[model samples]
Target: MQAKFLKSLMYEAQYKDYSPDFVMYDTLLEKNIPVVEFGSGTGRITLHLLEQGYRVFGIETDEDYQGFFLNKIKEKGFIDNFCYVTDITEVVEICNIIYPFNVLFHLNYQEVEVELNKLYKFRHCWSKLIIETDNIQYINSQSFRSKFNQNQDYFFKEFPRQSKSKIIIYNEVIEKNSLNIVLKFEYSLYLHKADDLNRIYNQIFPSAKLYGDFNLQFYRKNSPKLIAVCIK
Candidate 1:
């Protein structure tokens, strides 16, 4: 992602509420174990976990997002409870929870397999691995505009027609006064079906459980998300 686009996303978080995935992970604080969150964008979930007295180690690939993430943790005075690294292989400490919240969707099938295999090595180190991703069946192409701030607005559109195996997202930010585009970017990701994801999970961790939503409900055809929880 571009730096400007990432900055816009960080701003979006100021207005938009936390996702259901955040709520789901927050409930696991009672486990009282250290957490390692992959793709910890802007430390949204990481901050919540840290505020709840749980130690969290964030792993993110994007340098732009990492800068904002670091600033937020410092601002909240939760720097002690949180730390971050740009590479996953650099994580040597054992954590009880592995959270890749809303992250797997960005990987292709091959990349997903590679990541799962790498994570499998830490099975003994972490008791649980929770992955949250889109339920491909439920994804639809749509467009809408929303307020970014007092003087700016963002127009978002998704076009999933380019390929059967991938989804494309387009984002644009415009200044209301000048009606000029301030930022624009396109993001694309491989589309993974529920069955395909579950099959991979079972192959790697046979004891994994699949849920359709944040409520821990059983998966179904029309569910909005496919959340997998694998226990060691």
Candidate 2:
């Protein structure tokens, strides 16, 4: 009903056809060990795994997305396999953790260090940790005539602001038909190079592997997405 929520929904819809990030981990995510998805907004990856019969626990704190995620879990016609996990300690199982999409980008490089350190304590409980985020070096190299992009419902603009520590994105969502600005917000992202992230992950986990994209190619400059797999 709200413009921001509507814009967010439309943004997610655009990724519906992109299945590589959502499906690539299927075999690694064992059915016996629980699957934990951080930032499981609107039940995209959560529902996909559930449909495949893998029990999933979603960790999210946003109330708006939480409401939608809960409703979607009910729509799946069963609640036994999916969990809206409020506390990480609540899940007491050896698990495969998914920290996908914009989840990591929301934290700055220092914050990433802190978070990964916290996750490191759960090394025994987690079998693996997968993180997907934007490649700041690649994105910064591009020259865009417009910072704006759109989906079916609304047109939005992302202004990337860089400071000593983080790359923050300031967003503006406008009404579709009227073209009137409807919502404005901003969030921070870690835009450091692959080696920076790899080092941090390696310090926390035994092995850390990074890919440029979902195809699992070795990470290189200009790669659009940075995907990291840390093995316990």
Candidate 3:
């Protein structure tokens, strides 16, 4: 397979089937406020919302991921309901914002507070500011943090090197038949206390709430995920 096509293919296989966030996003949709999905990778949620008759403005810095989904949206005839830009600063409209999945892990609590303060003061619609991330505290508590998978066409592995405050995940994919390396991804995810995030966001939005998962349950120390929803 061609490199770009192969990467796109792998990306689809890795992410397409995960839909827990779908239910969460659906319940929060507002007709008049467009959803601006930060880190909207490959239109997973954007396309879903558009298909449900909601407008979406996707912000993604990765051009390859953006292009892959742009074509899909065009084919689905959802162009009128969606727009995309590479930078967050380029978004000018007020809308309900979502930092779905692990996108919030890219920033520490201080950084998140600073960014949310700026967003809340300027462009935030004040209806919602949804942020999601894995429970780094729980994840770090586990001894086995590595993962491996194999399929007919390719196999993938995740090797995480945890430090004091960040986890560096090294990922690689290999072709099955030829045993050749197909793609390698290295990423750093910052760790933050869920309570710290909740407190900081509460300062901005007095009604900020913390959930343990997509089901919107109260956060516990051992929960696998942390979801913070700030509503004014």
Candidate 4:
């Protein structure tokens, strides 16, 4: 699927509201100075950080999302507070915090190691790194409907039959008036278990802490999300 079209549908159908993850990060605002967010889709979290007076640099791989993010921030008069980078290595070396929100899961185990190693190389530059990911055990392959606006809704389904290491998600936007599918797209992502994540990070950065949710609580077996906070 094209990045622009997928993002437009996602933003309208599912990402219109602030996520609970946002609230969780908000609590740590004071500690997240001069932040850098990886895979910052359409400036959702990036805009919030900029509005709160933080100097944020976003690293987005998608050209469409980068353009959309720049336009939105510019309109909000926060253009100066934010910068864009297409590669992680291009980021300025003085940032204190790094946010890899749901980006790690997009990579396979080997790829994740490479990315983590890259971040580890800059361990001395950044004091803290926050990683958010879906809890593989908590998610089930199923179909559901989500209400977007009064006139439209999204039908979501997941297929995990391909392999244990990955899942394919299918999304369709339906118009209520005609009950017709207006938009459809599918995307795939690699899956990572909590134990695997913990083992990987602990090996690289021994002091990394793992939490079950955004509330900063200890990781439970059944938590919906996995969050890792690594301090240098």
Q: Judging by TM-score against the true structure, name the best candidate.
A: 3
User: Candidate 1's error at 25, in angstroms?
Assistant: 1.5
Please give the CA lDDT of all the candidate structures: 0.68, 0.73, 0.76, 0.69
Off by over 4 Å in 1: 1-15, 98-101, 138-161
For all the candidates, what are their Cα RMSDs to the real structure?
A: 3.8, 3.1, 2.7, 4.0
What lDDT tens digits, residue by residue, belong to model 4 across residues 1-232?
A: 3333545545534564666777777775454468888878787787777777888878777665777777677778999888877655676565645454678876889988888888898676676778888766644534222234331344433223445557665656555556677666666677777788878888887888778888888877788778878876
Off by over 4 Å in 2: 1-4, 134-153, 177-179, 210-212, 217-226
The digit string of per-residue lDDT tens for model 2 on 42-84 reads: 7778878888877888988677677766766787674888888
lDDT of 4 at 94: 57
RMSD to native, candidate 4: 4.0
lDDT score, candidate 2: 0.73
Local distance difference test, candidate 4: 0.69
Q: Kindly list the per-residue Cα lDDT of model 3 for residues 127-179, writing each as its tens digit.
A: 67788877665443453378776655878787888877788888888988889
Candidate 1 lDDT tens digits, 1-232? 3334445364444533655676677754336678888877777777777877888888877666777767766877888887776545565656655555557877889999998998897565666778888776644443222233432344433223455667665656555556676666666666677889888988998888888888878888788778778877
Itemize residue pairs with steric clashes in candidate 4: none
| TM-score (C-alpha) between model 3 and the true structure | 0.84
TM for every model, in the order presented, reads 0.81, 0.81, 0.84, 0.80
Q: Quote the lDDT for 119 in model 4.
A: 85
lDDT of 3 at 1: 32
Rate residue 158 of model 2 by lDDT: 72
